[model samples]
Target: MRDYPLENRGAFPPHVAAGAGASISLAPVKGGFVIHLLGDAKSDEAALKKALAKIAPELGADVRKSAPNQWFWVGDADVSSDRLTEIQAGLPSQFALADQTHGRVRMRLSGPSSRTVLAKGTMVDLSADLFAIGQSAMTQIGHIGAMITRIEDDSFELIVLRSFAGSLWDELNHMAAEFR
Candidate 1:
């Protein structure tokens, strides 16, 4: 597992912006906050959403609600740790949270054929009618557990475990090349 290092300086590289058809690249969200709600309070969606509303505008467009009890706050890596600390303070005692700053990596794919590229490895239907922009789901792409977010009309972001980033990227990049 001697893959290249994480881009500690910024969110990720923008090289893929130049690729043809569907471009594949690491999303520039170096680290983000992953909220893990626990206990009975976890089911209080309104309270949780309200609490996060304080910072929702700050996170801007990167805020992702991947699941019922899972919310990801995406922002600059340097500010994420402090931001998570502030957020946890507002959480109820029944809830738990952690900063998955180094455990995850986001892969971005965009263009007309982008969904088709990911469909080769993911069982989740990436059709726009079902998974529209601003929606996200926690699912598996091949053997990798990923949080897939449809960022735009033809753009999707795949958040995967860092341990499988290399292998997963290899698999996706291989399929995406055909669209080039």
Candidate 2:
């Protein structure tokens, strides 16, 4: 897939907040990156986890298995692009890795109202009772393919393909306006 890299304007409107007994916020997380470890994770999960522990331990924290052979490693902006290159080269030969860093738009949504706004279009049941913290799923938001991960009790990182980020942000903000 072609990459659509975007410049961080740093002047977008606030996306996270609390008001009227409802709370939520959206913030641009700088340097959000991802690596698609698209391979046999089920067979090599233990070994892959071991290698990651020695190299980049943060990867093991939220490794989402969207399918039997498809896994995506979520990484924060703190992880440098150069480091991503290094890790890709160091992986075992059985693995097929792709640098999806520039392919996604990463946004953090937090607050009690955040889930409500997201649930409007999400297909999965997002009840905290079902999707607790640290859990993630590949689903659609605003009919756009998205990966939602509850990184905190009331916070989630919604990573969408770059092309859909802006529209998704607008849809999310529109839904959030009710609580704002």
Highest TM-score against the true fold, candidate: 2
Candidate 1 versus truth, CA RMSD in Å, comes to 5.2
User: Pairing residues by index, what is the TM-score of model 2?
Assistant: 0.80
Poorest stretch of ten by lDDT in candidate 1: 1-10
lDDT of each: 0.64, 0.73
* Error in Å for residue 124 of model 1: 1.2
Clashing pairs in 1: 11-28, 12-28
Displacement of the residue 169 alpha carbon in candidate 2, Å: 0.2
Task: Encode model 2's per-residue lDDT on 1-180: one tens digit a residue.
Answer: 223444545323555455646677777666755777776534576677677677777555356666676677776645555666677677776767676666776888888777888888887888889999878888998778898989887888887887787788888888887877
Error of 1 at 153 (Å): 1.0
For model 2, the stretches where C-alpha displacement exceeds 4 angstroms are 1-22, 58-61, 77-82
